[model samples]
Target: MEFGIFMPNSRNGYIMAEAAPQYDPTHKHLSDIVKAGEDNGFSFALTMSSFRGHGGSTQFWEGSLESMTTMAALAKDTTFMKLIGSVQLLLVHPALAARGAMTLQDISEGRFGLNLVPGGWHPGELESLGVWPGYDYNEYRWEYATEYAQVLTELWRDGVTNFQGKHFQYDDLQLGPLPEGGRVPIVAAGASDDAIKFCAQYADYNFRLAWGGIDALNDIMTKFNAAMEDAKRVVKPYVALGVILADSDREAEEKLQRYVDTADLEAIEYMYTGAVTDTAKGGTSEILASMDQKGAMQMSTDFLVGSPSSIAEQLDEWADLDVAGYMLVLDDYVPDIKRMGAEVFPKMKNFDQTKASVA
Candidate 1:
């Protein structure tokens, strides 16, 4: 399987605990992480787009770099490895998004992709910018996203677009120079059935939270594959996993306990309450409601924490489910990255370093 680092564009990375690595979301730090991934054998690096922060003592995700601009700078700095940046469809017009994507594609020499998010969960983020579609727009956000994707794809492939829809309109619009490959890959997360269908139809890959274990993951993949078959197309499946490694299993367990002990309960509560209240109709709200305190603190994903050998064994077990790859969420950016590259990567059964080098 392939591997990629979930670049920490936000403060405190993915972990919400105060004990986690506290660092500024600076360009130099991000660049260092990207370079480490390239030097290692990673296939890509993805950054999430966040317009606002979840408030608490830790100030989780309070400060973040804009995804597209950050990826553009990384594209100029790196020679290989795809750079995936996120965009919230509600915030930017599709035409402007397409033009920015085209520029990024050129900058990366066709090594750029997009992670599209249909905004609704964090309404305040868009509302502050005067772009939120209001309360009634929650249930139909995906429908709007479909139109948004259609406009973007048309502009990229046909170089001109003339269309009108309930959500967006374009009249004889043209964009160029077109992306080098004639198309840029799209990635998206699908928590509900309709969202899964949308990904099968439009996205090159489907990203899901690694909340459930192997059996749960298998069920998700089965549904995703069925959706693809129904659509007469195939889309790869990826999972987001947090990693915390140590010299031994005991040490790793201790560290995990510390993360939980100092957990940002207020921050976690805010996130959970917000999801259930603002996104009551969405599938993710159900998932959030089902999570326990620890699960919520870990962002409802499996934390692959153990010695190198144990982590490798867990990864091998996960790969057996035929996952396309993993987007690793690290606790500490630089040190953990170097250790993963030097230790854990060599033990992975599905990763071929030679093939990655040639690719």
Candidate 2:
């Protein structure tokens, strides 16, 4: 399996807590993380496109960098690592997104990727930006996003699309100069069942959280593989994991406890509330509702905590699940990234950190 950082372009880096290192995302910090990933043989990095935050003490995700623009700059700066920028079809029209994605593809010389996102994880986030179609949109967003991808793909591949579909109608619209290779790799989170269907049809890569243990993951993969079978196309899966490392398991557990002890309850509640706002079943939102206190507040599951070897063992267990790679979410990015590269990388079993392409 390959590796990637779920780059912390959002504020505070997914740990909703007052005690966690609370800070705004910066260009230098984001660049440093991707650069570290490159030096360490990480194949790709993805930044979420979040326009707003769930407000509470830590102001979770309140301050954010626009993903596409940030990645365009990264495309120019980095030489090899694949940079996947996100676009919410509701916010940025596919015709327009085609332009931005095409530019980044040219800039990165074919190392750029595009990720389709919902209007926002929360409806209010898009509402605040004057783009929330409606709350009922959550139900049909899967279909809408599929159509959106169709248009974007057509425009990028053929340079013009007269495609007309339920949500979008592109009449002789054109975009140029086309992306290198005449296509851009697509990524998306296959959260709900419908979302998985969309992935089978459209995305080249799909991300699923490693929340449910192996059995649950196997079930998801079964469903995904079945859909792929029907669609006659394959979408490689990547699992996202949370990391908290130390010299020993005992120390790692203690640190995790401390973060839990000081967990930002109000912000956590806001996160939980917004997550469940979607009626879609079997997604991260539902997982949040089912979690007990620590599970919910700890943010994500499939944690790799302990010494580097211990973390490697955990990764091996996950690697057996057979994903395209793993996208790591580090509790502390800079130091954790360095430790992961220098220490843990060599310990993992059957993992490949080599890049096959650049420039």
Candidate 3:
């Protein structure tokens, strides 16, 4: 198993709490964190795209660096660690995304990954920007994504495309200087049946968030595997984890409890409400499950809050799931990157053999 750092391109990182490390994002700070990850054994860097923030005193995600541009810039900063950027389908056109992928891959010297996002989990974000589809589009998430993927592949493979689909159309559009060799590896996320099938067909890696417990995670893995079996395709799986490192498990718990006690309910409510808005499977609605069971402010069981040994023990279980990589999200990135390097990773089971290379 390898590791990746989920760049805190968003304000305040992943945790939505006033008490969480509140500060403005900076390129210098972000660079320092991923550089530390490169020094460790992290294999990749990922940045998410966010258009709006949940309303609250903290203004969660109100300000964020654009994912594509951010990754392009980070490409210049890192020697290893593949970098991926997200493209929100509703906000970005397929042809444009295809070209952008080519540019980033070249700029990164072939260390670029593309993440396709089927937008609509946060309707308000799209609506605010006037890009929200004028019609109902959530139910057709995977279908729309399939077309988007087709467009991208055609453009990348042939350097031009003449296609017509329900959601998009291209009139023999041309994009020059295709990416070297072929298409960049793609990453996508979703837990719904549609999502699973789509990943099996198109994405190279599936980004997932699993909760409920060991049994539920097993169920999800079963379903995902079944989909891949039906499609006769193999797509790697990865997870996003919120990490809190401390000298002891008790210390970590104390820190977590403090944040939970002061969690920005107003902002959390917005996320919860949006997550529950659609009945679609494996979307943000999945977040609702963990919020209901573990507490809204904190993340799923994937949230690793403990000392190096304790975190390693927890990770050992996940590594058994055959996860391709673990995307680490930290409250404070730079310092935590250093501490994780010195303590936690050295003790992790499946990842111990990965210490030699940046990837």
Candidate 4:
């Protein structure tokens, strides 16, 4: 199985200050994060894009770096590990996003991938960018993304594509000298019906947040399998995002509780209050509780926590669960990355390689 790190471009803490805090926009922590991943044998580092911060009374607003630019910067900073630019398909036209993806691929010597997000933020961001065409929200976003995927595929593989859709229209478009693979792997994320269906239809990999337990993941896998069969397409694989670090169960619990204690509850509350479109309904306490129950509490079964041997064994269990890969989130980027690489990775290397043979 492949592994990667999820880098947050937006604010990622539990507590929010009254005024927006100025973070290290240059992403000085990034080089170390990438180096740690590469040395530890990770396949890639995924960077996300968010245009604005979720502002609430208690929320902390922090500026974000653009996704494509950040990927290119990280590409120059690291050698072996691939980089993924998580782009919100609804924010920009497909042709433009494709060019951005292709440019990164060229700069990184074909070490670039795409994670297509359907968007889950306030409508004002799109309106400010002059990208919002209508207010159907979820449906409009998915339709735009569906066409976006079509355009990207056509431009990359077919040289030029002409297409029209409800939200976007384009004449002949071409993205040249595509990635060395001819097609860049595109992953899509969303749990809603439209988003899930889109991934089943076209994505090379589907991304999901670790919500419940084995049963929850199994339920999603079963649904995805059925959807692919109905569409007469084969589902590729699904990768999950989770926090996975701790040398012992006790240590894991302590670390998780620390995060919760320090967590910007205000930001989460804002997210539930429509600042984040997708997870708006759930209350902050409910969201936090769910994360805890879903393994975020004290390292659920989904996490690869504990000693190297134990973590490796945990990875094996996940492999059997049809989790082709994982994108790990770390509170302290450098230290956890170093320990994971120096201690945890060697064991995982063996575990990952032996899977195909076993299957």
Candidate 5:
């Protein structure tokens, strides 16, 4: 199975706790982490786009680097390993996003992908830019995203697009300098039925939060695969994981407790409230439920916290489910990157280092 880092595009990575390693969201830090992943045999890396962050002591995700721009710069530096950047569909036009993705593809020599996010959750953020679309828009956010993806695919593949949809319109426009790969891989989270169908139909990969352990993941994958089969398409399944590792299981547990003890309740409350209030009707309710249970700790449903050997064993359980890959989030980047590269990855099965290189 493939392995990838959910690159820390925001401060404190995804831990959302005061005890988590604090780091600035800077290009240098990102470069270091990506370089470590490159040296370690990670297949790909993806950056999430967050316009604003939860308010609290740690300022969790309050500051973030622009996803596309950062990936564009990283493309010039990395020789192997695909780079996936996120596009908040509501924030940018499809034509603009398509061109930026093509530019990234060229820079990476075809090793580029796009992660599409239907961004209607943060009405405050959208309102700041005067594109909020109002609260009721949530009901049709997925529909808008469907058309958004259609426009992007047309522009990327045809080089010239002329189409009109309920949410977007494009005249006879010619966009040149096609990507090196001719087509860029698309990824989207399969949170709701609409999202699952959309990903099955258009995206090459579907990302989901790996909560509820292996059983939950298996159930989700079963449903997603059925949907893809119905759509007559094959899309790989990818899940996000939050990991905490140490020399021993005891040490790992201690670290996890520290994070839990120092959990930013204020931020967690803000996130949960916003999720319930701002999210649209068709979005994944499971995610909100999980967040409620976990209190916004950013731990995946199947969180991994153990020694290298135990972590490896747990990963084996996941691999047994036939998952395509994982997008990993960590409490700390610098040390954890090295640990994952040096310890856990070597013990995991099917992740042959020799074949991990993207190029």
Candidate 6:
């Protein structure tokens, strides 16, 4: 399986204030994290895009860098790691987004990719753009995104697209200096049924939160595969988020709990309420409840927190479930990234071959 690092642009207060005393918005700090990942054999780094943050004690989003621009910055700075910008399609014109992607692809020498996020903040954010429409916004948003990507893909392939749809229309548009091989990989994330259908139809990768162990992943894979066949497309493997495997299972649990305990309750509360305003499923309690029942939040491994050997065993289990890659979360980016690269990756790369030889 491929390993990717999730570069945290913002952190909950409890985690930020407690875990690392030196949390700065300086270029040096961020560069260290990126350098660690690149040096460590991590293939990609994922960053989320958010336009505005709801303010107050419970900060909705405290500090987030713009996605595409950040990716461009990282691309120029880093050498080996593939940089992903999760673009909120509703907030961007496809033509502009495609241009940005092509530029980043050139900057990164074909190591740039995108993730499609159709749902976003509600009236507040939309009104900020003066583009707020009436109800049925969700339906319109998804349809617009689908058409937007359709046009973007066409243009990226160096084709003059005269695409017209109720939500989006492009007249004889061609994007030049196109992306490598006339394509850029796209991933999509959501738990809603509409989101799943969108991934099945358009994405080269389906990003999902790990749930209920391998069985749960298997079920999700089954659904995605079925959808792909129905849509006359080949389904790619699921790339999971929130996987923080360490040396051992016990260590993993301890680290997760530490964050939970240290995390600013007020900040988390704010995030929960903000979700409601964002038209997202609300509350940390509710989210955790769902995760508990479904075994979603924890790493789907008895080995992740333990030593490298233990984590490798758990990874093999996940590989059997068809997980293509991981977007790993960590308490401290630099330390964990170095550890993952220095200790874990070498073991994992050869683990399967050793097991095969044994069998």
C-alpha RMSD values across all candidates: 1.5, 1.7, 1.8, 4.9, 1.8, 5.1
Tens-digit lDDT track for model 4 on 1-359? 77777775655422233321224445777777787777666676777777766654433445677878888889998876768888776666677778888888888887887888766445556666676654556446667678788888888887788777665577777777676666777877655667667877678777666555667777877777778778886545545545446777677656555544554555545444443343423222233334432233222224444655666666656656666667776656667777766766667634443332221
Pairs of colliding residues, candidate 4: 14-263, 14-264, 15-263, 15-264, 292-297
lDDT of 2 by residue, 274-321 (tens): 677777787776777676656765675666679888988888887787
Whole-model lDDT values for every prediction: 0.82, 0.81, 0.81, 0.63, 0.80, 0.62
Per-residue CA lDDT of model 1 for 110-190, tens digit only, reads 888888988666666787778876877767878888888899899999999997999877789999888876778888886
Reference-based lDDT, residue 303, model 1: 91
Give the per-residue Cα lDDT of candidate 5 at 64: 91
> What local lDDT does model 2 show for residue 218?
75
Cα lDDT over the full model 3: 0.81
TM-score of each model, paired residue for residue: 0.96, 0.95, 0.95, 0.80, 0.95, 0.80
- Which has the greatest TM-score? 1
Which candidate number maximizes lDDT?
A: 1
lDDT (tens digit, per residue) of candidate 6 on 1-359 = 56676666643312322332324244566567778776776667777775555443335345666778878888877877778888767677788888888888888888888887775433455556666664456445667778878988888886568998887777788788878899888877755556667777778777665644567668867776777788887645545544445656777767666644544444333334433443334212234333221132132211145566666556666666655667676656777778766676666643332221110
Candidate 5 residue lDDT tens string, 1-359: 88888888887777878887877699988888888888887788899888777778988878899999999888876879889999988788888999999988888888888999886545566676687777777778778888988887878788988878887777886677877556789999756777887887789988888876788778878888888889898788778887889999999999988888888888777666656655544354436534643546763345698998899888877878867888788777768878888998889875678867844
Error of 4 at 151 (Å): 1.7
Clashes of each: 0, 0, 0, 5, 1, 9
Q: Provide the lowest-lDDT 10-residue window in model 3.
A: 292-301
Residue 161 lDDT in candidate 5: 82
Q: Who is ahead in TM-score, 1 or 5?
A: 1
User: How high is the lDDT of residue 36 in model 4?
Assistant: 70
Worst 10 residues of 4 by lDDT: 292-301
Off by over 4 Å in 2: 355-359
